[model samples]
Target chain A: MRKTKTALLIAASTTMPALLLSACGQTPTQGAASPSSGVVTITWYAGPITGTGVRSTLISKFEKSHPNIRVKLISAPTSTNTDRANLTAEISGGASTPDVFNGDVIWPAQFGHAHLALDLSHHLPKSFFNRFAPGLAAGASYKGQEYGAPLFMDAGFLYYRKDLLAKAHLPVPKTWSQLYQDSRILQQKKLVRYGYVWEGNSYEGLTCDWMEFMTDAGGKIFSNASLTHSVIDSAASLKALTFMRKLITSGVSPSSVTTFEEPQAMAVFDAGNSAFLRNWDYAWSNSNDPKVSKVVGKVGVAPLPTFSQSQYPGYSNIGGWDIYVNPHSQHISQDLTFIRWMTGTQAQTILATKYSEIPTNYAVQKNPAVRRVNPVLNIVSKVRLVPRPSGTPSYPKISQAIYTNINSALTGSISPTAALKKAQTQIDRAVSSNSL
Target chain B: MGTPNPLEPELTNHASRPEKKSPGIRRRLARQGWAFALPALTIIAAITIFPILYSIIVSLNHITFTSQGYHFHWVGLHNYSVIFSNPLYRYSLFFTVIYTVVTVFIELVAGLLIALVLDKLIAGRGLMLAVLLLPWSLITVISAEMWNYIYNGVYGVLNALLIGIGILHTPVVWLGRPLIAIVSMMFADIWKTTPFVAIILLAGLQMIPHELYEAAEIDGANGSARFWRITFPLLRPTIALSVLFRVLQAFGIFDLPFVLTQGGPGHATESLALLGWQVMFQDLNMGRGAAIAASTTLIVLFASLLVLRAFRAQVGEEDLG
Candidate 1:
């Protein structure tokens, strides 16, 4: 009798959580807008509210409709880890705050191991997920599990002077070789000081720039899609690195390229100093801004040039943000609803047109109004989107290796071959060692 | 003509208490002391001691710093060994040492020279000190940012002035080169903090008895002789205290480099403090980060002790002999 009772207790304990989980999942999806549910103040950690009313209009509308759901926006500066660190601290300490968070384009891979974000694939409908751009949807998913929906998107673009190219009697450079040649001829004619400019700093931006070059030349950071093997020391990677070096040493790009971030590169090209610049689509708007730009109405946007045009217009490194639900949130259903509502068509349209947000929705990107505001969207709507060096838990470590060694080559501290070799070794070590 | 030191708050008790006080009374007094310090002691433990002990425990284990909580692999001394072997960490440490040593040395010499000049001026010294201290009183980030604008490649006043003066035929990117970036950082640090060092040294100068200089003049000694023999010898303790403070602060500096160069132009100015932050927060390697913090603490402790010993030896050279 004692043994039977003990076995019954053990079986009950083993299946209890599973049964509870199933019941929990069903209750949320089936009774999402249960009228009986009371007010919930769910937190949404996001970028600082800008003056453009992109977030404010959506939030006010959201609040006006959903009287019972209050979204407490925890604001943080853009392009900083302060907000992520805060969420990490709170959630890791088991605090059920920030029901929703605006995660960076490259954050999902790191957020995967932490189990801090809820898996949206289980809760969000496939129809809803299918509305997003395929690249963005894939970008937001880690290891076949969707954790968030893309908030908006941006892609790399090759910004060049239309007048300079027209005057020089040349078309926009279609390949890296062509760009080098055109930039040289333009510089020699005293039309521009430098031929090409890009972010070559030893930071995360360099990693993005390196990825752009690597993908353009048909190089991958890893051999497999799972990111298990580091096959970064490729001949194509060497060619790309060497080509970048030639741009600097051959005086096509200024030596200061090693210190230039996006803003600096934009400043250089927008000042009409460089013939071509590689930056994100934001530069297009900035170039047209009369207040900041000198090259208004004279700038032309094209895809980053590749080795050859047959494969695709050169790959555009994906730049965007996503919104994820916190695993430790008390109001998971409310947060999910908020995400869907926030990333909804109307809300995304308002955000896209008003705030210069490049919405990740395929429909929104095709919207005539958004394209009018952002002219580069016309070209970027069909460009190939290459993902950053991600998918592993140690994504930051791998990128650090790429950026640091590549910067060394750019600054002449090491040869291109040596830098690529060192980067490969470091990335391999980081990948294998970081894995269990 | 004589005045009591306002700094000594316990002077009354020190003068009134008998040297042969009873043991029971002393014990009661000690208990009273503890009663007074209880609140402060608890607060200190909560703020600093607890975190330090917790960090020590964390440094021993290999933690993943995940949301579910840390998963420990239990690698003792392995983290420290990894840091020692890692070239990036070594490079960061090497630059940190150079930064601390070079900045401190320059600040000391510059501070002393300025203090000496102020001492000789006898009048308008107050005005001079106020002027010198204006930059120090400004926020460090603001100063660093100002320096960054000056070091800007294209739209900077520095490049404009250099080109206009024919000192530079073409613009040189001050922040685009590693060594130049480090030097520019040092220049900014010196500009903002040399005043602080000067104030400390000035106080030391004031503490020296003027009669010694008068007697040295009577002995036919020159101005340099008086400074070397009387001033330097007498101001050893004050110099040591100030040196200790500067060394500790410089060893753990974060804001200036962070704001100015961001340890950039290829990680040329990455300090130990910046590295510690990147490890713990950016990379989320709290285990190794703790080890780095511990190592930096050890370095600061040893460096201060070495300074103290050398100062003690200097004091002994004249007073003991």
Candidate 2:
């Protein structure tokens, strides 16, 4: 009996910690509303969109428009990956709050496949989907079912220093080579400390940057609509990656660009260190803000440059958040109403004019008043847009393969050829669902 | 009552009452002890054991989620095979192992040196220890963000200091190159955790009697000789304990890399924990992710067992001596 007890004690102690090793991925379920209250409260989990008051303002306005439905805002982490992880854990474990969430535009396919999101296409009318700008609705769908409502639209744009270009007596660069030459000339004249900066970090942002460069060089990630195969190891992709590496080696961009995400790249440009920046629509307002920027009036917005002058405006990777509803939400009808109002004219106009977010509503996007509010909005129609290979539910893994390999090449740890080959291998494995 | 109790003699002597030796009384006392501890044990079992078993079960299945709930299809050992064949998983395992080995070894050595210095310190020792623990006191995610700024190539404090002293003409990207980025991450980890190791060693140092040093000095033993012969041998158990803790913590490192690098400059700094998180949450491949998690747990368990065995052997030797 003593021996048995001792053995049991030893086993429990040793294995106790081992058992603690696995994650207890339980999300706190929201308390349900009492039936007698007659007013419904829905939780909206949103990350910081542009500014501090955007969510609150939208919530207050939304509450005024619909008196019966009250919205509770649960601010999410700023890191997109962290936000995605939290939402996934919560919804997968069957927590019933966060009726609506603001998620990355690329998450629809993965979330839809997992059944974490409510199919908006089924609940909403066909005419409701038609109100969004063309391609926005399609981008928010997977397998012909829409899981998200496009809240706003965003695409990459070139933000350059008007002062630096004027000092070098150069016009706006029409092609990638022209931009490179202009950057070199400006750096040689000591007009700017660095020539160019963009998101080269190993994350989803890098995939977006890679998409722009690869598409400009006439390369495609998937050769077919099915996205079952990867064609990353191609000549056009090599040209794109090679040029990206050259920017670092030739001192046109700081070697640190390999570690840069959007914020860091933008900070360098706004601090008067770099001649050009590649970022989203919000960069226009950010660069023009006197408090956070040194180049307030000197920044000029333009469409991203192409590889050749003939394809003058390069492809800008489509990026923006979408509104998704929790499948486990208690108030599905209220969630639908919140999504509809958030995507409607009043909210879209406020987002476009006040926050400088690119509106997904076609009417607000084409509104002359909204166009006059920011220079980024004026050039939105001219830039070519390319979506990341997010059609497959394996998109997150596919993007990881793209960014990690491309970043390795950019950091000079591996050659562009080797990186592309590795990426191709990984992407193939991802699509096949045969490897982790 | 049918079996003899190995610890009965010690229990009876401690109790110092002849009647307490009765099997009924001892068994009742044991029952009461268990009754008092049951609540905490239940909580621990619920939180830890249940999830661990669930996670192991998850590893053996292909899972899908619908509006209704999860759908599990068992595919025994398939998930494990997938992770084994995946190059990313292999790389992450390799990286986590190397990182743990390098960081833990260096921390042990550095911590020993700091503890020794502080042990001999005559003035302001309390103040010094408090200051030493400042880095340890800071939340890891917050400190990682701080390190991010310090390692920033364009405007980093490290770059500015190096350039100001004319060490180089231009800044080096500390987190850009794969090799350097790994080194940078390791340095950040060592900087934050060395104090914890040092404190543990310091407590162990204090527990050594002063008479041992006196006895050694009278025998004409030098500083190095005394350290090896007296201080080191007596401190073997403490050293083993610290190593066990450090090894377990280091092997599962996540927050530092997740915040500072996000396993970047090309997956150079990706730890096993980070990779598991990416596979589980980001990819939503629950089966493969649980397999990664289960495998990580087994590796950690194996490493800690080796540590505990070494500790037990040292204790056995001490008893013989």
TM-score of chain A of each: 0.85, 0.95
Tens-digit lDDT string for candidate 2 (B160-243): 999999997899999988889899999999999999999999998997778778877998999998888777876777887788
Candidate 2, residue A15: Cα displacement in angstroms equals: 12
Q: In candidate 2, residue B70 scores what lDDT?
A: 72
Model 2 agreement with the true structure over A200-238: per-residue lDDT tens digits: 999999999999999999999999999988999999999
Residue runs of model 1 more than 4 Å from their true location after superposition: A1-39, A48-53, A81-83, A434-436, B1-27, B65-68, B71-73, B313-321
Clashing pairs in 2: none
Candidate 1 residue lDDT tens string, B29-88: 889999999998797555444455556566677876454556777889878888888877
Q: Cα lDDT of model 1 overall?
A: 0.76
* Local distance difference test, each candidate: 0.76, 0.87
TM-score of 2: 0.94
TM-score, candidate number 1 = 0.88
Off by over 4 Å in 2: A1-23, B1-25, B317-321
Question: Docking category for candidate 1?
Answer: incorrect
Please give, for every candidate in the order listed, the TM-score of chain B alone compared with the true chain B. 0.87, 0.90
